[model samples]
Target: MKHVYGTTALLVATVALTGCGDSDAGPMPGMNHSSSSTPTSAAAAYNDADVRFATQMIPHHQQAVQMASMAGYQATTPEVKKLATAIKAAQDPEIKLMSGWLTGWGKPVPTPSHGGHGGHEEMPGMMTEEEMSDLGKQQGSMFDRMWIQLMIKHHQGAVAMAKTEQANGKDPASIALAQKVQAAQTAEIATMQRLVGQLPVS
Candidate 1:
């Protein structure tokens, strides 16, 4: 019975850690007033792809929020933490943005993000489970190296998802958000690549 309780507690902790974003972190960038002043009325409401993108992306953004948040605690350099800070700041507001878009359009907000990494396999640049585990266990230079690598990969995945929405989504708000994601993640990818090159690990 004690063992069962311990296992349950461990599972809860793990779930809370990975499944919830922003435990010890600040809000993502541009997280101000959720109601965009005079929401841009789109030609049509959300589509299936819009729903898929928002539903899938809430957790994906949350994961970036989670990893970016961890950097402040574990990273050694300002650049690493700066990039992490940027990611955390940017994603938080976007999560609310996407959620609001859904609510305004009478679509459902994303289901609460679940366990396991996001479900989009075609999306670019995600790290494997082994890599995430290795990243979590590392410290100092090792932590810095792993964080850069994983975050680069994470940003890449986000960009891909945004691209999918850009190509297929109909809603004005979702498409605008997707475009913003493309610009942001693309810039971050370049920055992350440069940072990783400077790291001793690779």
Candidate 2:
């Protein structure tokens, strides 16, 4: 009977030690397994596609913010002003976020296209100086109509870039951001189309 109790006690002790083993003695909860190939940081995981997406998007978003900023003073319709406000509010922060990601990856944040930054290919939906100058000169209903049209074209370009990122980018965060950009811009495009329909002829 004593031997039987000793065996039971030993089994119980073993189970208790296993259950109470130091939680931090092995790999941490979120840690990658110890391997020579593990990335040292999330930024180290970014590839060329991720770098390109961030660089392209920074300038693209800057232009959108510039356009939206004009609506505060130039847009006629209450809806146009409201939509512009929402757009600027949403995109300004995203510009910062993408810039942050680029900086973390030791990549150069592209200059805003308005700065005449050279070498980079023209991003889709960027307004030429002539087009932007024309838009800037309009007022009242004319301004509202032109703004909606240009913004829709701008958003379509963004959606295209985002789709490319989704398909080709290897970084998880960049891919997730690309998915978000595509979904949001597609919805905004629909909104702009509806606004266009409501505008009076020319």
Q: Give the best candidate by TM-score.
A: 2
What is the C-alpha lDDT profile of model 1 across 1-202, one tens digit per residue? 9999999999999889875665444332222223233232241456888877877788788777878878989999889999899888998988887766667667666543453654646445655567767888898988998888778778878888899999998766677788999998999999988988888762
lDDT for 137 in candidate 2 is 95
The 10-residue segment of model 2 with minimum total lDDT is 32-41
- Model 1: runs farther than 4 Å from truth? 1-44, 111-113, 117-129
Please identify model 2 stretches exceeding 4 Å from their true place. Answer: 1-41, 117-121
In candidate 1, residue 18 scores what lDDT? 74
- Model 2: per-residue Cα lDDT over 1-202, one tens digit each: 9999999999999988887786554544233332112322256466888888878888888889999999999998989999999989988877777877777778777766435535324678877777789999998899999999999999998898999888888777677778988998899999999998998775
User: Against the hidden reference, what TM-scores do the models get?
Assistant: 0.72, 0.78
Instruction: Supply the TM-score for candidate 1.
Output: 0.72
